[model samples]
Target: MLPILDWGCAMYAAVDCLSETATVLLFDPNAMTDDGAAAWFVDAGSLAEWLETWLAGTGWYREDADEYEDVAEPTPWETAASRIAE
Candidate 1:
């Protein structure tokens, strides 16, 4: 699992790579602690497509929240975006 965004609340967004696909898993702190409930699971395709899906907000990882406070800059996402530009 490659973590992309961390809220410092134990809730985080991560990418899980599988043999055939890549997925984004959003975990809720309390719920995960209680029942291992993932807030979101999205099949975002390959690494590049996953980044695109994230930016477009057309997948399971929607921009439902008003805003997200980044615990750190998501450098991987930036790197992926740059790759797409090339």
Candidate 2:
């Protein structure tokens, strides 16, 4: 009886482990994408480091938000132009 209970417990643990692994495997899009962008962007790195690297060489710093507040809202002309480009 004790041996049976141990086997049952081990089976239950193995099923739970397999369930979690399956969920992760199913949702991993990098396994499907050609360029593997997901793996590149989400590699072992700090969030701040990622953000800094992304914003580098671009003029779009968070500090510029206040400066552009007045012109932040898109004009109808700008929206129509963007839609046409898209």
- TM-score per candidate, chains pooled: 0.43, 0.21
Error in Å for residue 20 of model 1: 2.1
C-alpha-based local distance difference test score of model 1: 0.49
- Which 10 residues in a row give candidate 1 its minimum summed lDDT? 70-79
Tens digit of per-residue lDDT, candidate 2, span 1-86: 01111113222101112222211111123333453322111111233432343356222224565565432321112122232234
State, as a TM-score between 0 and 1, how close model 2 is to the true structure. 0.21
Root mean square deviation (Cα) for candidate 2: 20.9
Candidate 1, 1-86: lDDT as tens digits: 67887847776767765425655555554643232333434334356776776676654445553355432222223233232234
Model 2 gets an lDDT of 0.24
**Residue 25 Cα positional deviation in candidate 2, in Å, after optimal superposition:** 15
